[model samples]
Target: MNLFADMRAVVISALDQMVADGALPEGLDFANVAVEPPRDAAHGDMATNAAMVLAKPAKLKPRDIADALASKLMDDARVALADVAGPGFLNLRLETGVWAGVVQAALEQGSGFGRSDMGAGRKVNVEYVSANPTGPLHVGHTRGAVFGDALASLLDYAGYDVTREYYINDGGAQVDVLARSVYLRYLEAHGQEVAFEDGTYPGDYLVAVGEALKDKVGDAYVDTGEQVWLEEVRDFSTDAMMDLIRADLAALGVEMDVFYSEKSLYGTGQIEAAIADLKGKDLIYRGTLEPPKGKVPEDWEPREQMLFRSTAHGDDVDRPIQKSDGAWTYFAPDIAYHYDKISRGFDELIDVFGADHGGYVKRMKAAVSALSDGRVPVDIKLTQLVRLFKDCAPFKMSKRAGTFVTLRDVVDLVGSDVTRFVMLTRKQDAPLDFDFTKVLEQSKDNPVFYVQYAHARVCSVLRKAQAEGWDMSDAALAQVDVSGNTHEAELKLAAKLAEWPRLVEIAARTNEPHRIAFYLYELAGELHALWNRGNELPELRFMQDTAEASAPKIALARATAIVISAGLGILGVAPAEEMR
Candidate 1:
């Protein structure tokens, strides 16, 4: 059903024939040979660099190889035209029936039209929104949550066995601070006034956690110091905070396959095992790290520590795994976590980190490389900051989360669909402005609305056709003669639809889900363009003068909806049937 892939197969088969005829060398590498859509749509349906790529290896001139390739390609009925463009680039135009077949394929496939087997069912763990378990998730985590969830779903569509995961940051000092903050609230719940200080959380979200703690133990910890209750309170508060985080994620329709506790790596010999493995490979050693390259920390001092030879893998410098005080550094637990992932037999690991964690990327990648002996590749995707705006003014901080807007706050303002779609309108590593005013507008400027409207428009066509007593089932459309849809605008839309499978493979290979959103927007635009064209040309409308003529046009519109629904499904957005 993938016309592009089919055409590439055609190109490859033709090249094999060329080798048989001795027009090209037998052993020339065809790995670099590619058939993709021409940059300019006017050029042709697809453009291949087969000639340009093999010319040097075949010891032939560019034009000479291209001419031979073109003749071989034109021998097939599907290749309507194959012209040699500049520098031996071969642009191909397919027969109109090819596009008609694509429209029928989409109807037959429904939402599965563009699904790919690019990943070949490889196990991939996508860990994201591992925000500290000290508070509810905030705006930064919102982008990460959306991006990770979408990417996981995208990989699934591309035939990867995806596991959505979250790494709970409960083993860090932040949770200790959360414990102290909750203790103050517990006192307040007992009618004793307390102030939230510099080293504690002050968000009102913890007020209920404190009350719940008092309900559980009554007055047991009322007269005790940190020694008697620090661990108990830390565990209790972390559970409450994790509950809050889960609810926040649920509000946005995200569910995780695993909630990996960082605390689980502590005192369990997991950290020791991971580091010991590295040590056995001569990767771990006690050494002194060099001073900061630029501005050193105010508390920076040279100290002998346990270091990992991360530079050997690809990092700029070796990284510390343990400090002189015998405490494992933050990177140590992360290494253990990834080692656990590799041990679990995942073929790949993908971590969705906030932009602030950019500095940790190379070292983490190096650790995974060393841990799996380069067998497992870890792809770290950094989601940039999200700036929220309302009515042209910056959105205020949430009273619940204290200093920043919480995920619940964003989800509540605009429903989860809008929030998720708007978050993906920009690349994960680029800053996004989520303007409440702009996103809700019913215009082309709002991509979620525009794309959803396209799906709804197709539904409208279905409803009207049904009301006219015309059979509008996909099977009926599939049986019709859609080759009659040779209109230039109709052909253009089918051309775009043909790119869906190609785009899915590219996005999955690159681990970028935003590309799906961008593609959907472009497809929706093309659908809207054809809809607009129908205003002046009655024959171009989906509702033609006769049911026989209308079936083919309806087939095209339904096909567009099918792809949009599939794309939106990958993005975790519910395709709209009717715009409310």
Candidate 2:
């Protein structure tokens, strides 16, 4: 039961009545007419711009149309008042019973309270954390992983059929570097001293992979040259590294529905198929690219290369699909991968990339546009860097990942719930600060704990009520009569709860899962504020000596808990029953 939607429907119906009365023109488009919370809460509970948007089209003055619309809207039983505000805005005040109904609906729906059908069951493929299988995931990858997983869950709650995917970068030179590094470790396993050069990975995480290679083949490639063991070790090492990466993702509560291998596109004619699809549309050609502006590579020269006409589809320039040496460029496999996604019949595609890949976004979107003929839309979200801090100082690097902090390191320091929540506390494109000390603090300054504490507090209320022999189970709460409660604080919390369905649609439509986190924080704040008010007014408390007197108040508290669980569920955070 979305009260905002219910109110919007009432507004639209009233507008239709105005059209019948000839106060407004017939067949006017009402798509732009929106009913939402006023900018200043002091204005009214809700405001609609129907008159403002229709003024020019209807050949009427703004205030003139608002005056007529306001009178018609005031007739609805749920609308307490409809006053024409500045220029043309129609501000609405809903009856207190309307907010009371929202609390009752939340208690009835439980965790399914805010689930929406905004997506209409469209299939969406979300590809994220496609890091090279060279080592365990680092802090940067961790942010993308958490963001992507939460997004998938959010879309699912919003009624999108989502598939979580990982595209393995096994066809790159990085994997070959990993192969050579593991080979050196293999030699060390055979009792040979080895020194890791500048380009080789020196992390001790590969030590076990090397030792495992010895157990599997018993030094068959001992003292052998690169040709004898390069390919074999490359495949073996990539698998091991992928296993390590999978484990790291698992520890962070991420599980992918698919792992697409870049190497598969190499020998499988997939790249040719994708390129041919674009070439058929006259988007592929051999061309010379302009030298990058500002700073050109020292070896910069205009060379003829196979290029995709990405400029036709919104990119700055055509991108090279094949290098001058006739080798497939890095962009080739990415094109094939997206083409594969389109062929799978997904209605939409979403890629979660690091901020460094910002330049790559336009080209990837262009490729998908050309492949799907603009039928399937692609949304690429770039997550910015995460700066770690401890005790007000930047956290040190991880020895395991060799260069940056590993995902496990952050998760180990705080927890998976805190890591995920803190990672999403900011917009994806904005840089985030992950302070170890601050996140672990049990204070309102910490958003994760604050939201969790609200849930825990609700549970405590229910437990205390139960101890006092007040029946508070779902079945029991359903029997509560909410007709007696009319406190402004209680009504304010119900109003917040009523916004959940609307919030889900807004967050999903923008493809921003962080919005859900932000909304949950606000909702929790309202709930906590209401709970705190009970200390000053005994009548507002959840438990009462008589079940007849307590039912309505406790029912409101139960309803608040229900909405909290639903919001937290979308964020993949467990609603805490008790705070430690």
TM-score of each: 0.98, 0.98
RMSD of 2: 1.3
Error of 2 at 410 (Å): 0.6
Worst 10 residues of 1 by lDDT: 395-404
Model 1, 513: alpha-carbon shift in Å? 0.7
Q: What is the C-alpha lDDT of each candidate?
A: 0.92, 0.89
lDDT of 2 by residue, 70-146 (tens): 89888889889898878988899888878777777777777788888889999999999999999989999999999
TM accuracy, model 2:
0.98
lDDT per residue for candidate 1 within 146-251, as digits (tens), equals 9999999999999999999999989998889999999999999999989888778888999999999999999899979999999999999999999999999999
Cα RMSD (Å) per model? 1.3, 1.3
Question: Which number leads on lDDT?
Answer: 1
Off by over 4 Å in 1: 295-299
CA lDDT, candidate 2, residue 332? 95
Model 1, residue 210: displacement in angstroms? 0.9
